[model samples]
Target: MPNDSPELNHEVTAPRAGTAREWELFVSEDATESPRHVGSVTAPTREAALERAELHVGRDAATLWLCPADEVTRRTAETAALSNR
Candidate 1:
């Protein structure tokens, strides 16, 4: 682990399935108590994906787990349909 912290806003982009997206991890002092700023990640398996993302961001902070690709597609469609009204 890196003892010295770098500036925030660090991010990494890589391939996923076919499309590409950005994944980042960082520390947030504002978090309730401990450092918690594990950024977002997208992958087939949430666990593995988050792990990879955490490594990229290089900080031990809270995380927002992402759902599977199919679930995201379904939810997006549902939200689009609802907003079409």
Candidate 2:
């Protein structure tokens, strides 16, 4: 009998050894506003990403969000225009 399990069907993946991961930083100035991408940082872990972000852009930010660059999708107007052709 074939075992059918959703959890078992998924493959786990991790960054390669000694590779630095890029993290995107977002900052919001106040509670009423949404966070905007300010810059990116390359680090080995989330903690290090936060420290880098704080040093660069988090000093006056009301909130900060750090997301792995690979996990975020971005498309710019220039790219969009090119794709239309």
Give all candidates' CA lDDT scores. Answer: 0.50, 0.85
Q: What TM-score does candidate 2 reach?
A: 0.66
Worst 10 residues of 1 by lDDT: 65-74
Q: In terms of lDDT, which candidate is strongest?
A: 2
TM-scores of the models, in the given order? Answer: 0.31, 0.66
Candidate 2 lowest-lDDT run of ten:
9-18
Off by over 4 Å in 2: 1-18, 76-85
True-structure Cα RMSD, model 2: 14.3
lDDT of 1 by residue, 2-80 (tens): 5454664443333454654434344543456554434456554556676776576555444344444343332455457
lDDT of 1 at 6: 60
lDDT of 2 at 24: 88
lDDT of 2 by residue, 1-85 (tens): 7668998776445544458888989999999999998988889999998899999894689999999989997677765785676
Q: How does residue 68 of candidate 1 score in lDDT?
A: 47
